[model samples]
Target: MQKYLSLLVLACLLAFNASAQQLRLITGTVKDSLRNAGIPNVVVRVKGTDFLTATDAKGNFKLKVPAGAVTVEAIATHFKQKEIMVGASQTTVHITLNLLQPLITDSEKNRYIMDDKKGLSEVVVTGYAAPRIASGIHIKASPQNNTEDYSPINENIFHTATDQPLSTFSIDVDRASYSNVRRFLNNGQMPPADAVRVEEMINYFDYQYKAPTGKDPVAIYTDMAVCPWNTGHQLVRIALKSKQVDTKDLPPSNLVFLIDVSGSMDEENKLPLVKRAFKVLIEQLRPQDKVAIVVYAGAAGVVLPSTGGSEKSKILAAVDELQAGGSTAGGEGIQLAYRIAAEHITKNSNNRVILATDGDFNVGPSSDGELERIITKERQKGIYLSVLGFGMGNYKDNKLEILADKGNGNYAYIDNFEEARRTFVTEFGGTLFTVAKDVKLQVEFNPQFVQSYRLVGYENRLLQNEDFNNDKKDAGDMGVGHTVTALYEIIPTGKNSPVVNWVDPLKYQQAKIMGNQAEVLTVKLRYKEPQEDKSQLLQKVLPYSRQQIEQVPEDFRMTVAVAAFGQLLRNSAFKGTATYEQVLAWAGKARGEDPEGYRAEFIQLVKKAKLLDKE
Candidate 1:
């Protein structure tokens, strides 16, 4: 017995030693060869394994890998992926990646580049060279082939205050448009006019608005400044800041990852990016939280049953196993995911179905109206839906927007891994946890202080004035740590404007001026608690304290700059004197306390847009 025990211990020790010997600590830095600058957010992965880590802001990464002949791969946007083989003795590596040059196409026509390594067909501007198609690769042809969808937006026209006193809209917290527009500008293409939602663009950055000190979940703030675009007009900025919740204080989450593994998702930025993004979210989960994964291709089915977040390896494995193939059955997948969420529903828990897709629903109940109806019915079960749109070319923004709006959730477009980090890490609480639902805003302009007003953006979120008081009416949801902003360009009561043409005195009943003379406008907000059916009302009056554009707060100025940029992108008729140069100047001055560098990146994007506009 003693001899047997000694042998067992020896055997275990030898096995442990062998395992340790097989592991190697690898460190590396990835840099742009042309610019000699470190590349950040580059994915460095070990081939044939799920071992991957992104480079930090300085392009440095460290990971453990199995010893022996190992293949290391580095991938980043706008850079050609590269792979290197390391021997068992190798402990450090330096990788250099080449930037992809824009294709010079003839007649300004669309050009394609085949990324064989990622099995992706990337679209680029104006190229004459023949596309190099990989052998043995079959690209599927479907009804929704290579065409992106966006809902048309007719820019808001000036409304006379006496003729139309109330301007109502749902508060949009979704920042998908900014990232989507970034994607277009990054790819050297001008985005469609409808894709530029100015309200969303303005709401993308964090603003240091005052936190709620009352019982309400959101605090309201108003700022009045000389309009940067139209000097004769004033820009009224309405800001709402939701209460912040720490990660440790958040409720236990019951999450269902509804992933679209359709053929259209085969691109590197689609299925692979989805898997990587979910991994980021999975790391944020606690033992008390649970996650279930449901993938849809030709049919909808569960890849992993509801499992505790402690079993992260298992959930990650399920996500990694998902592959893109067959047709999309998005509607069926939605039903299955919501059913799982409902079954596991608990009181005071954060229950949500996160749908990751390119928004291509071809096989089952694919129309926007049909999917909207299905989501509308499912949302009543207390299960919210969050749509993370992936990929381009065939992206269906219109459908995704509708699903999120009607399903009482938020929509975001994940154009790259950095965006994935922002969505899942920096804004984790705001992305997955909802604090208030059906949040609507109704602004009553004081005819005494304002002549005509126009909502700067949010064309799609505009609601009838009656809908503000309707408890059953669906609207946008406000998440923890969310900052929502809306800008209204107003021509002061006596200012004559080219845009605002007064009708020869109202033939019908004219609105009586009754508000305080010192007030610019009265803003009313309605919202419901996450688990409540009834809505609560909050109101605030914007005092007529107009400040010069230079004297307003930095946040107010930054938001105005963003709105102007959006209008420039859309080429709106009301974009009075709003040049890209003006946007750059205002944004440069107001780009304050950008810890995340989002504002700096916005400035860079504006520079790019200026060049593109000239082209």
Candidate 2:
């Protein structure tokens, strides 16, 4: 028995020594640099081996490694992979990961870096320049210096102590914006092989109108009858007319043009396109308008100081000299541009900084919070901002939209030359001129007529219930001639609708029946005068079951189809009774006399997109 015991002890010791020699244990914690929080679900794998393990909820990871030196890799979605080496017997390791890329669709892949060698083949070309005829309305849409009567008193008031009054405003969606989308989808092609920016698609139509020329403080107008293809629904047109002002407008102007000249901007659709767009504005500027240009690449710099707008040649030359290279320093550029604008701020005229980019701000101030802070601080200087997104691929739509909202600016995506011309030339007045600020829309459903509804699009624009009345809260900016659209899908009361999913009844409670059926949707608009700190309210009501009105007009139906297409592109959850074929059929009926051939182009785009979808 004693001999057997000795032999067993020797065998156990040998087995323990062999295990220690064959394997080594490794442990570590993975954390995010900015958030300083553990990143769970990170995969840790032994390089060149099948062994793998994931981090715990607390970001702690452990792995047994083979005896010799080995490489351990860590990977997570939306973050760059990280690797570390472990010598034999190495015990603990610590790691920090900084996310390198943003989450976007494949359509936005090559947006940030310019591929000059590829030339202009990637760009979408449009027809001859059709000069816009000013309809005898005395308005200045470009940045300029003048003491014009049109300037509002609150122009320089960033924050005011007085109780300012708010007013109500309404927006009619543009039917033309969706024309191409409808046509393209109807023909079963991808909505133009080119990029289809959803914002431009919605902003292209002109709705009905009641001139603000007199009676009401605010009135809207549209000419839906002009389109031959409209069918099924009534089109509500709202035209925002500019306030009349002479050359000696209200105040001198301070303008900062923040441009992105990163490596991604080397393409003709980016840098060259931007230069051309600005040329249109430079020609329209007056001497009183002070212009400055700030550019960012590997670093940020003020390329041009505040100069007279009349020096069009100099500004154009400066624009032409720009070459794209290096990384993006968007955060730094914002800081510098704001400082320059504030330094030369005019006491009366419009003071604003316009940022033009592909929405790719990769290097500094990359996080949402960091960029938000920079924009929020600049807002305090009474300088408004406008974001003009250009190019595609790596386009940070989510970030651009957020920055624009926080900075009290409007956001528009330019997918082609025509779009650039529209924003910077044809509708220049509405694109740059501010007619209303802090515009908030709240619809109080008549619970008696409607059960529940969901707002389509504008997910990022959602506001809290109390934010509607809070005068201090900043909202969307409405430019002269600009129109905004919001839509809701409602489930009427007492209807056996598939749209609604009933919830379980409360304990000892009976289902409540809606008592009245008079009201339908009540739209409340609250806004501040262009320059004011106070807000005013406007109310409009649509009664329940107006057979005449609910019988959607041709133009309205066409717009609905366009909206449906947008919802489809975004993969929205609220899309109901909307299909590509149905949308195409509806659009085909509304293609009225499209002289510019835009409708035909849309049909082709839709067909291509559909094929891609199938593939």
Candidate 3:
């Protein structure tokens, strides 16, 4: 018996030693080939196993995997996924990923063919194939049942500064338009004119403006230079940056993920992508934070009750088990989510309902007006709404924008996994945490120095002149670390401008130049604290400058490129000489320190646009 026990012990020891020898620590770095910079938040996984880790801020990662020949995978947002094989003796590895090139999928080609409503018949070109034309450009058309909706935008016309000196609008922080347009471009089609919101595209890239130095939570910066599109006109760039909150200082959150699992969401990019996006947000939650999963299809139901963030396993399981089917009852789902949020509302906590959907509400008060009324009423209860639009064919951009606007919230369209990472991981605070509510801007131009001016973009966000000061009127909200950018093209006094029409001199009242000659404009802003009912006022005076466009900051030039790109896409009457080639040139030069490669991606989009325009 003793000899037999000794033999068993010897066998067990040999097995344990072999197991230990099979494990090895692997260290590696992930890099972007285009920018030659390390990429943060990249997922490194040992293929065919559950061992996974993420790169740190510097793109460094370490993980233990079985020794001997093994396969590894690296994945990141906006970049192509890559795989590498490691030899038995290797302990260190390096991986480089290329940026994803836009490709026209079969579904994208079919969307164009199905859209007979866009005045496209069954006409075929001699050189083009059934689905793809040369250079991968597909003939632009909407699907017959596309059901996609965009609000019509009448381009803002040049205003006579002497006749209308004040331009008032709400500060919009939503950047859905940029991503939506990107989706269209990536699909090898041009987006409808109404889908290109110029201000949103300009605000999409972070300008890294200086944060607030005063007690206020927001800071304003102004710059003026010769307009690139129209050399005769000067462009005024007004930027507002909100104070950044440290991760440790972020308030505990009470979040309800209102996910749409309707039949329309059955596509891989719809409900599945939403689940993946929510997982990213889940990774950011703290022990004090709580999240609930509320899903809607035929009806709304809670798959998981309010659970502490520490129970991530439980939450993830609930999310993974969700399936998509049935008609969308978005209104019911919203009501349930808000009720759940209100029940667990914690004082001083960030309470919000994140609605992830394609904005297809087929049943129960789905009209834009009805939905807006619902969101507006719920917003008064201290529960904010953030809309995350997913999918494409039947995307209801118009309805989603209205829900966000009325709910005092922000909206984003997640077209791919990279965008999902950007929204939920890279921009966690700005997408979810509100810093200032009811933010409004009023620019009063000096007629002495300006002949005519036009506020670019922000057609829907325009507010009445008196609405700027009315505390009761609700406006847009700014999130933590959010930056709002606005542009105004001004024709300097005595300059020949094609957009401006001469009018007879005022007969009854003579115009007088009362303000300082150097004062080009006075910008008045109003904002309310997230929990406050009353608003606070802030103002700044802009001094005139003759700075040329070439002398301005790289960020300013980058914004000009984006704005011009937007105008060209929209075919604006006031686009002047803006061309896709010019946009590419300006953007290429201004792609500074593009660690995340967003600006670089913008340049690629311009290249695609230039090619598609030729088609």
Q: TM-scores across all candidates?
A: 0.76, 0.63, 0.77
* Residue 310 CA displacement from its true place in model 3, Å: 1.3
Question: Per-residue CA lDDT of candidate 1, range 279-390, in tens?
Answer: 9999989999999999999999999999999999999899889889999999999989988999998888888999999998998888888888888987888888999999
RMSD of each: 26.4, 20.3, 26.8
Question: Can you give the lDDT of residue 572 in candidate 3?
Answer: 62
lDDT, residue 120, candidate 1: 26
Q: Measured by TM-score, how close is model 1 to the native structure? A: 0.76
lDDT of 1 at 589: 92
Query: For residues 415-500, could you state the per-residue lDDT of candidate 2 as single tens digits?
Result: 56666666666666666666677777776655454444445444335567688889887777666655565545444444232112
Model 1, residue 199: C-alpha shift (Å): 1.0
Q: Which one wins by TM-score: 1 or 2?
A: 1
Model 1: worst 10 consecutive residues (lDDT sum)? 133-142
Local accuracy by lDDT, each model: 0.81, 0.57, 0.81
